[model samples]
Target: MKSMMMLMLLLFLMPVQAGTPISEYENLLITEVVVTPTDAEMIEIHNKGGVTLDLTDVYLTDATFSNGNVYYYQVVSGAGGGGDFNDFFARFPNGASIAPGAYQTISINGSDNFFSTYGVNPTYELFEDGAGADTVDDMVEATPGSIDDDPGGTVAGVSALSGGEVAVLFYWDGNSDLVQDIDYVVWGDKREAVDKTGISIDGPDADAITSVYLDDTVIASQAVINASSHAGGNSWQRGNLNEGNETGSNGNGVNGDDETSEDLNNTFFEGLPTPNAAAGAPPAPNLIINEVDAVSSGGEFVEIYGSANTSADNLSLVFYDGDTDQVYQVIDLTGSSTDSNGFLLVGNTGLSPDVTIADDSLQDGADAVALYNIDASAFIVGDPVTVNDIMDALVYDSGQADDAGLLTLINPGQSQIDEGSNGNAANESMARCPNASGGSLNTSTYQAVDPTPGVLNSLCPLGDYYATADDTNATTLRNTLHEIIDDHIVFPYSAGTTDTWDVLSFADEDPNDSNLVWMIYKNNSYTWKGGGQQAYNREHTWPQSYGFSSGSLGDDNAARTDAHHLMLSDVTYNGNRGNLYFDDCNAGCTELTTDVNNGVGGGSGTYPGNSNWFDGDSFEVWNFRKGDIARAMFYMDLRYAGDVSGEVDLQLTDNPGDIQTGQPFMGLLSVLIDWHNGDPVDSIEQIRNERVYSYQGNRNPFIDHPEWVECIFVQGGACTTVGDDLIFASDFD
Candidate 1:
């Protein structure tokens, strides 16, 4: 019943307006007025009236007192006009006009001597049902049902008890249309938590002032009655107040729902103990390219790639050696477009690949080898490869083979003659240098020999063969193939939409040239397949194996999880990536096997791969594309893996033993090594199952941009594409 009554009352009071009158002689309705300290030196007057009223001639007065005498003081010397819901006091200018009806206010610092001269004995009255400080009968004895009743009967009426002290009565008229608005009030040592209590009855007759009391004892005869003019009190209005703690809101009449000045703070903060305090700097991108080798004896360049995810002004790249004492240039990347947290940090190039690499065997100053296409001839024919050399190819060089004997065409064997020191051997007819027929072919473009200066040089030379061979016929054939899959490569899709494609005929019998993907928008359908994987298969460019999910898309979900699962995969070879996210989970074996046979099987009549690796231990089986898995996994890890200390509190290790024990997917490393060695498939079948791409789409971005892949390939002797001639010649060797 109380709740219902309060609800109804709230509804009724929601629309009530202050009933201040417009007459020149009418009294100003005072609203809320409060002083900060109990012994505040100055007083403030607040008017809660409904309309504009003049206070210029109106004076605040205080009744004074002596041993046996009483007095009063008129506080203001000049008359000032006050506006509706506003205020005017002796010290400060006018504020919001007093409204049309009930109001409450407070006053302080006015003269006390004048009250003694006017026969007004000052008293600190703690009122029960009250409105403003000016009312004579505003004080009442503590009542059982009154809203102002506190835990203790600490209420009292005005009666002078000591010098340097004063008090005033507050009243709320029962018949007034407006309830009094109280912020808080204080005078001398007396304080009250205001309740807008009032009488419901109307009367033209004056109400007698309640008897003055001292120390809980009533001095009935000393009580003074007030009707027309009350003294020592003033009223004012509340102006702009903001909605947060320690911060003031501005603008007129802008009150917070609660005392937000004592509450609420920064909305974005989490894990914070106090209001208005920040935790620390946000998480940064995890990228560490420890050492970059250009495989050249001359100076080489290296790049560290990742999003800074801060304002351009805050984007800085610092480079240092192992000791941290040797530092490189500090590059300011303030204007990069990839600074947007959502966009891929891109085009932030680093070193060129033309730098020379020194052989470990040769003396420090002996002849150095230059890196052209990731192959280093500085070392002996079969010297054990260095982690540094592999990282160099991964970080700075690309398009080189990962085998024992074949000389590299791009970074040729160390011989002056066209014939290699090893032999002229397995050189495949060169693919056109630019692959002009395919507008966006990946293997065609030159790698970024130097990124800081933004220069791209041609990859493998077309050589004199271009003038000797049927160049026109070859280009026409390549063009025809490009035309077949022209529209399938696009990027940047609207969120929450799927791109669909259909398998079609290809030039030659290239399986990668068959299928295409497209996005539907409005009435027209567009193909935005991007590169690599789009031309290959619906490869989870972000490997589905590492908890990557197709259904989740945002940073909070798919991008978050899949971001960790990136790697290159053959569309056909990815049969190994089966339905299993991770092969170690034992509880969901049946489900894993089923999912692999269904979604990832690619509807190929034959099961994805039936190698011994796929035997009965469901959790032990992996579904990666063995034919192309090594480079893919390397790319995936390079794309997403960063300094993860911030997110999962995990650490990264370069130790090979960690991949077999300390790491979660240690077993997969061996599988990848075997796949890279072509152990999963025989020579002919390995070549047949390889996934080729135009280098469009997120899946094949590294292959499309070998410069970026150089950072990774150099660290591991992993190769993605092999020249047919190189493979055949190595077989003969």
Candidate 2:
């Protein structure tokens, strides 16, 4: 019974058939070598992989071909197929195996005196750098008893090398068909340096005493190492504790620091190489739900980054309502992986999610998303889950964890939950900054940025050049700002359809759909796929007939398309409003045209303002829209104030119909100022200001700073320098 049990256990633990290719393993590499001078030739191989590997089919070749002159020497004798590698150099014994994280030193033919320095067996290959003049290598027990492999024989250098030609090293993994070219180094393109395509060529020149290592990945992209990259001595050795391949680092470059241990902290350092060891911060979570765009107009999404040396096997993204403990969705990431740069996106499938999650799982504001290392089958709502099993947990905000005010990070040293000025608002998403640096997920790490679901965050452009804080006298501030964002360029009248749509969407909502839309004319929303609108057209809030048409005397000018005064209203309403003027529609105000008396367009409707009354000729903007209209009128006033042609010097009055017909003034500065104050600044207007500013390169100081309207028009704040040549604005108080 005991014997049967033992046999069964052995069968279960035995290695599976080699269905997977060698490339599927982490990696094995040719870490270092003494390539220059041939006499004391030797090269080092490392099992940088996670598991011990059988070397039966693996082989190494020291060869160079130039001018059709093929020079070759092989290691692992019969393994180098039979081509240019016809000759045998030094070889590994029959069934030698390299334990995980171990190194094999093969010493080629050299002085016996040097070989005696280390007790471990070392074999050799015949690959020379630059013939008789090649650089000599330093030999010693780089660290005694470090390597435990047995020694082997050496083959002679086929030909002495001179400087120009590159000596190539090919470490192929396979027996029957040398299929896997694990790694190769192409140095010095001087002579017929036949660069074997398909691998990254590392470094410009070869000079360091240590092995030139690949700084970013497992493969060496260069054959040069910084002197400081090595430890006490100059041998670029393997990581101790078997963490990962020791890589070099540039500023903020991927470091050996997988965040696992200090030993594997970074590739670049000034210390003795700690061979065969574990080190670094701790591997960045293999995959992290680094960013989430829960509030988006198009669709919600989650972005992930792979920061460790692991496969995307059983990984899954789960979304939950922290309050309900109800698991909503599970997105299996099986076989899905981040790009070489460690980025993967998942969410609304239409946005091209790598592994789509149920759209309902994603919700706006206050939710928790976790990267679970387990499979979906193991996940259950209300089931107890341990943080130890979580690769990363991004809690949107605190929601009763042990009754704590803030959700304590299960592994929080860095940001784990998106916090701070992440103004959890509509159409915005929180994302990691300086990305993939898996630390604590807090405000500093994850920030509220514009929704950039499938890509990195592009923070809203808040330039220092624009005026923001510090309000001054409205008139003075207005004049000061006018000089800055003044008329730089204006789109053609033909461009108004697109521009007007943008303006409309910015400041107002489409009554028909409530979604921001392109209104070609009132009651008509322009469809990009369809033809033009019917009765909808651009209505100049400050009419065009006041000597400021798209073209003066018929030449299309900026005023014709300046978005500040452009609006989309019913053709009937607009024609009714025309160039008449704006005034109080209540029975108290004068010039109450009979148009209103005769059952025309005066209504208690929900528009322009809470004041839903319109005068006959001068239409009354709704109370809600009053401020929006007032600000636009004010912007139009200031924008053209400095026009090159003094012909359109408009006017402003405090009374209805007080100005003559041909005069430029819109009317009643007092009324406009009152309207500005009544409506005040709101988000809709602010959005309009931002969008319009983006296009016109100008701002309505009135909307931005309503108080400024009072300061400039009421507080006697008009610019005295440019006195008359103006009207009511010249002398204020």
- TM-scores, each model vs. reference: 0.22, 0.35
Highest-lDDT candidate: 2
lDDT of each: 0.25, 0.47
Error of 1 at 40 (Å): 29
At residue 51, what lDDT does model 2 achieve?
Answer: 70
Which digits, one per residue and each the tens of the lDDT, describe model 1 over residues 1-733? 9999999999988977644332322233222222222222222233433345433223322222222222111111111121101112111112323333333232232223213222342222223223335432122221221212334543221222211222222222322222121122112211111111121222223453322211111111111111011122321112212211222232001121111112111111111111111123322223222122232233233323222221223334322221121222233434432221112221112322222122321111111121111222233332332323221112111332232222121133322111111222122111212212112111222222211211111132322221221213323322332233223222111111111111111111222322322110001111334332442334342234333232222222222222112232334334554432222333333321212321232222233332212323322333333434444454344333322321211222234344321122322444444444442333222222221221122232333323223223344332322233655434464
lDDT tens digits by residue: candidate 2, 1-733: 9999999999999988763245423255555534333333345677666677665545444444434443222111222111232222222434656777676665544324224433333533223223342332312111111111113312233322222222232333322211223443322222322322222222223332222222222111222222112222333332333333423222111222211111121222222222223222223234666677665545777888653223466777766665554566667777776652346778776787776765545654356677777777777665443454566767664222331212342454444344334454465567664344334434345666666564434333333434533335565565665665465445434321123443444434443454434332232343222113545556787777765753343223566567777766655656656676666565532221211211222333333323334555566665556777888777776667635653365556665655555456676677777777777887656766655654455566666556556556676554332223545454544
lDDT, residue 695, model 1: 16
The runs of at least 3 residues in candidate 2 whose Cα sits more than 4 Å from the true structure, single-residue gaps closed, are 1-182, 185-194, 197-287, 296-298, 306-311, 324-330, 372-379, 397-406, 410-424, 434-442, 460-733
